[model samples]
Target: MERIIGLIDMDCFYAQVEQRDKPELWGKPVIVVQHSRRGVQGGILAVSYEARGFGVKRGMTVAEAKQLCPDLATCLVPIGEYADKADIQKYRNASAEVFDVLNNFDSNIVVEKASVDEAFLDLSIYVDNIIEKFKEGVDLILPEFLPSSHIADGHDKNENDDERISRISTFLESSQNDISLLRLAIAALTIEQIRKQIRDKTQFFCSAGIANNKMMAKLVCARHKPRQQTIVPFKYVREILKTTPIRDVRGFGGKMGQKIQERLNIMTMGEILSIDFNKVVESFPDEHEWLLSVAEGYDSEPVKARSESSSIAVSKNFPGRNAINMVQELRQWLDGLTKELAKRLVTDQLQNKRTAENLVFALATEDGRPQKTLKLVSYHPDILIDMLWKAIKPLNKASDEQTWHPKIYNLYLGATKFVPGIPTANRDITEWLNSKGKKSSDEPLTDEIVFVHEEKKVYCPQPSTSRSDSVIVLDDDDDDEKEVPITEDDEEYIEVDGKRFSKTVFKNLPVMLRKQYEHKIALETARKLKMNAKSSRKRGNSLVAAEQSHMKKHKPLTSFFRKK
Candidate 1:
């Protein structure tokens, strides 16, 4: 059976959400920004089409945007503002509503959300059902592209929606058994319905592309802007790919595209397809199969539904002179980011019942240095802070001759590697191993044998021993049946025959040794600190002494010449 896929992308998602909430802002330039009371201009997150006309773009400062279009409107989203408020939540809710609409379209609809603004839908099931209905002699009225107010303003006003639909429908209906053309027609009709439903309920505009696979669907979705749909016929696939840059394809946009351009000296899919398939396989050994499939415009990848994000990150950028210089400033950002992550983790735990195990902290410096990352086990807030401080300690310290402080410009904290299932009743095996097979400190061992190796003797708890039993000693097998002998000494000792043994059990040795080792470690740490301080002082003194000696050696030549 032929497959039909569609990628539906919401236009200017964040800006559109703001405009939808405020009807008065319709058709006006809008830019969404992070709110700050510090009078700093936040970078643009998203901008409306009207704003784009004025040369405004994402990642530009609010000041630059305002300078371009003084009449521009800005929506400020507060970061870490309140428990009940968030800018992302608004967009997330809008995306959820869009997905809900898609889900209600068909009982077997396969929808995969690509982002907060776009999704991929496998419309093959719907199209097959439509074909069956048509075979049953149900009058299949071809759908007309709906006339939308959100259409690009410069689109030909003379174009009629019904005429356009009739022309394409008539062309496809001319060949009844051409499954490819029929599939394209049915897919286009389905997309038209989806767009209409989305706009009617969400007051938002979207564009869609219908193709045989996701790669082509996503690439062609951008062919039409703001409330339009395009269908790529299988016969014309070569023609479309001939002129399209290889980098414009989804997976080819990264370094792989550069490598292809460098090695094959080709920049488009048409040129790539001309290369021998064996050569293509040889060049990209790892991705050979995928490379060949995509080059031939045959993508067999499936659309996977992601009900929740794999990882959640919160980051803040400090540009130019606003770079972080002090430990306190870094700590402040960490505190805020941690709070954000904590909130997100709590929400995920409640909704998905998944707990993240790894906390990744990354920082980029402004001193022409490389970015550094540290991974730690996700712990409570207090322990997390200590770990963060230790991770950043190198940046906080100074060198011997001069204070070398790094200026950090970007800070990020993310949690990943989520373990599914609820946190309760989820105990790890390592904990049991270290705890000698006990469920927890409060639980009894119960039918479990714990092997404690101490002082060349193996000890096993007797089955009759109760939960409150402590470590006890047993005599050797040679004299097991007879009573053991005792030795007279300051320390407790037991003697069997001629041999003597200490009465100190492994569990009872803590009083004599634990604190002693701890004190030794403390002393070693203190000695290292003192040595570093003394070395620093010695270097300072040597530098001063060398300067004074140089001054004495370079005595004035005038004095030796008996000044004229």
Candidate 2:
């Protein structure tokens, strides 16, 4: 059985919805933004097709967009406004209406919501049925029903046009009595009825494609845009793909298309099909099979029914370097993302059944270099300020050197490893005390110390000057170096006199106490060169001599002493 796939992309979704609700803004080009601030230059969520023609694009700043077209009218995208329950219900109703209309034909129909305004429908069976009906109708309406006829004068017909006139008269008589003509009329009427039903039932204006495979069907759908249908016979599949760019094909985007072009020199789907299977595998080892299948218009991947997700993620790309102001901007984005996720979870009836585990954070430089971090949190909050802070803690510093405050362009946050936290575990005093090892009866250990296995380890070294005073007193007979059994289960805290002390306490303990308690177990480490002027002066003499000898010999250490 042949397959027909229809890719229905809405023409500027957000702008269209806004225009639909507000009749006055019908023909005007609309741009959706986050805010109307100047320096902020909020991201353009969506731009109408009319605005697109005037050089406006999604992600363009409102200020720059206005410069492109001074008359451009813009609207701030209310985050939860479009994704509200009412809006979602409306969208679902619209989708169901379209799906029901498409299901009328005898076909295996698969409808997927690609986005708010876009959906992909697999109508192979429907297309084939339509084609079969058309073929049957054509058979009925052809030569038999409309037999060739000729005009003849009575006297001349008998003499001059005897053979032709007799043949025409016989054919006309047969045409007048032909049952095929009656069947043809019936088929035509039936097609019109089907078309009318589809239009009347579903408000969505759709363009359909009838083809042998999904790829051909998709291509045919684009032949006539806005509201028209096109049918591509099985024979035209190869020719159609031959001229279409590889990027134009569904699922081929960004890096994938570039890789195909560079490795296989395949710019179009036809060229991809021409390559050998082995060569395709060599170029894209992981995705070769899938790529080949799509190239050949053979996709059997089933449409997945929507399910309640454990977590939701939202990510965004900013334009410039992330500064203090950018942090505020990130908070705003997180607020929007978290709000949307919460709304979705609540509406799906899975709110209390799940809990957000950790917030994953990622930052990208202007050139798209990314630095990612994550932090686990126990609570779900509407505003993700605490989560954001936890994620950013490792990257933040009083002095910017510890942080890569480069022109950060991208930020992302996601929750994962959700587990239901119901039926709270009973508190066990004996077990908790044993876990922390009962230090003293009066000083009850806290739960924070009890859960040591799951906590992150902190590393701090004592100052070199302080360690210099502690001299190693070795016994001649003590030849065996006792190895400390540092098991993975050991907590990061230092144990002193059967008491567990936090990392900060251990670092700032009195000098005498540290020497008495930790010096015996301390390992000797190499001294680090100070970046101060005094150290620089002393190192300068040796550096000059080393540089005179050879460039490579001192090249490595030059950057350390050089004035920044």
Candidate 3:
């Protein structure tokens, strides 16, 4: 069976998220930049198409972005508005929401999250079903299904969408025997639906690519982006990869790929086919034998869904001049991180129904090496602060409460050892609120905090002076170099009856959060009324028995004999 893979990449994810939440940002020149106390020196993380139209691109500083587009709307990666602390739980939450929608789209269609803004979906089952329907004369690839799809045939031609879809549908009807093309064409219809549902539910648009395998699907998905789907037929697979650079494929851009290119005298993926296979295998024996398979368009990596992260962490790099040794600064940053962690835990409960059992820390010193530590306490701020502070104190023996030497360059805080902590909608908020005092008193911290410093440390250079003032954030194409999106993970939620909630948006609500407060209130009120009526009847019966007992004790009534 031919595998039909679809990859969804969110366009300008950070900026798009900002636009989705704030209506005024629609159609504006929006840009996401990493903020620093150094002001507009922070680099641009993402650029809206409107801002891009003015020649603004990623890696440019906020100043340069605004210089190009004078009215550019600059949004900061809110690692911390007050301190250089980084916490981007919000982006992670958005990512979970996007993945949730895709995961729930079709049960048989397997979805694998490639990253926060990308997912790989295996549509083999859907394709097979569609093909079966086509054979049984019970199906038709309707024109409306692929309203915004394009074919990746190395063409620069454009046509009316209505004409193109109708034309494609007619071609598909006639080419029923060609299963290869037929499956992909049908897969495009499903891809269109996936895109539509994402937009309808989330208010965030995504671009999709459909191909025979993960590699081709990812490559073609990025072909036509922002809000479109591209289909690269099996016939055109080699044709497209003929001139494609190998660096575009993951894991092939590093030293290994360069060495292969130098030794094998190959640059494009298709060149591997032209070269001698035996010699190529001999040259790079251990590392890149799979290049040949991928070059031949035979990526067999299954699209498997990953379990929720065992750990949720937030880290910030101080980098050179921004490095901190002051005790006060360190405490403040840790406090900020803990607060972010606590908030994110709530989100995790709602999204994944899980929470952490222990707190973990990684403190990177000025030498660019981290001192890893683990603690016994839960995610509570005070316990974490006391425990994490004590854990750090032993390392900084030279310093006191005010300051320390050999300043810290990086800090990471996270929660791990996840246990189920479901945020049920029917959960009693009143009881939970009342448990705050007892919970603190009931829980105990008995385990001695453990610190395990990795004796093996690699020398990492400090962030250059230029990077301090104007750091350019890069694209997330390379997993090894992916920049962590930063902001408060305070869940995208609507408040109802003083409780925060994140839900699937039916309409006006932002995806993962909706406006059903009134509806919820109505149901809760009805439930309460039913319970109260039952209680009232029970109380009335008890009162009658008590009154009768009082009358019997008094013996003042003449007609007291009733029961035999």
Candidate 4:
């Protein structure tokens, strides 16, 4: 079966996301830049077409962008304010939503996420199924919302609607291009419908390129920009690649292309195709056959659905004067970054049910070479930071030996080599086999207390209690429960590794954690029950008093007549 692949690329994805969320930014020149003060020091993330008209491009510093287009709008800042921080979450969320729409289009539609803003769809099966259904006398219905078409094959969009319809009919009826035209037409219409659905659902516009393979599809997809698509026919494949430079080809643009040009003296796709297949194979043993196939505009690669990330990375940039110098500053930044990393690790643990087995840290400093370190199974930031210090200590000593001040600009922390944790449901079986209890390292420490009390009183620490007063001596089996005295002013406390927590704090903890404070939990629960009973009795007495007062205030008329 002939292959049909489509590449859908969102236009200025990050900027488009901002525009979709903030309608007022519509039709304006919006630029999305990385987080930084004065914005220009950090790199630009995306640029709107409106901003492009003013010569603003991606990767330009905010300062350079501002010089090119003074009216450029940054997604990080309000319309009138200065841009400071780059919020990347909105773009990430938008891309996921778009992928969801593509994923559910059809079960047979094999979609591959190319990047945050681009994806490839193998619609051969979907189109084949549709065509088969259509040929069986089933009436085909076109979507009510059709995307505006960009003129393909030298066709003029200004031409009359009737003339366009006539051309389509003639192409469909012609015997020479009948099957190809019908297939292309069906694929085109389906892609158009899908694009419309994406726009309707995501409120973001995208462009697509449909061809026989990924390489050609990606190359042709960019022919028309913003909101348009181009369908490259199989017959015109050679014609399209004839004048293109070898460097313009996907694989040819990298080191492979330079090698082919330098060693093979080949500079164009046409030249490479004209060369002997044996000569090419002998010269580039591993990539020889693949190179020839790509040169011929043929790719057999399938579009496979993307899986969850194997690694998670978090990094922070300290540009220009913002670079880290002092040890105190490094400590502060490390604390914040580790806290954030730990939070994300916990979240991923809950959602993905996977644990990272390796921690990698990279720091770019004045030395030009990044200080790097890799350790095993350090998920918590606090634990990972210790490993990080061991890695950086050598770098610090080297810098000290040189007697030069080190200015660190970039810090990278990545969790990789994911290992599936013992499944929550099957953990009991695994534990029984290993004869291991639950790991204490997995528990999160309560660094900051978030008190949620009904009385809304701020917890105040009293004078320190002696060991004798605080310690509650308990027998292994005590028939009589000794009540620990806790005044309204006196808070119940439990000491763990010398850290204290009140009974109120224990009560508010999750069930898993409540068990850890078993002694205090039991007492807290009983006290709450007693307090509730007392409150309920007070309400009952108040209700009876109100009824008696009402009866005395208005006596029954029959009772008054009998008494007289």
Q: Which candidate leads in TM-score?
A: 3
lDDT of each residue in 520-551, candidate 1, tens digit only:
34545665565566556666555445445434
lDDT scores of the candidates, listed in order: 0.62, 0.46, 0.63, 0.61
- Lowest summed lDDT across 10 adjacent residues in model 2 is found at 463-472
Alpha carbon lDDT at 504, candidate 4? 53
User: What TM-score fits each model?
Assistant: 0.64, 0.49, 0.69, 0.64
Candidate 3 regions with alpha-carbon error over 4 angstroms: 38-41, 78-97, 137-144, 154-175, 253-259, 262-265, 306-310, 357-360, 371-377, 397-405, 416-564
Please identify model 4 stretches exceeding 4 Å from their true place.
37-41, 77-87, 135-181, 264-268, 275-285, 316-334, 348-355, 363-378, 391-410, 418-564
Query: What RMSD, rounded to one decimal, does every model reach?
Result: 28.7, 30.1, 18.5, 18.2
- Candidate 2 lDDT by residue in tens digits, 364-449: 65444444545443223323446566656555433544334444565566666656431112111123324334365566432121
TM-score computed on alpha carbons, candidate 4: 0.64
The residue pairs that clash in candidate 1, if any, are none
- Candidate number of the best lDDT: 3
How many Å off is the CA of 295 in candidate 1? 2.7
User: Any runs in candidate 1 off by more than 4 Å, and if so which?
Assistant: 34-38, 59-68, 82-87, 132-140, 143-167, 275-289, 365-380, 390-406, 425-564
Candidate 4 lDDT score relative to the true structure: 0.61
TM-score quality measure for candidate 1: 0.64
Question: Which residue pairs in model 2 clash with each other?
Answer: 4-124, 321-407
Which scores higher on TM-score, 1 or 3? 3
Comparing candidate 2 with candidate 3, which one achieves the higher TM-score?
3
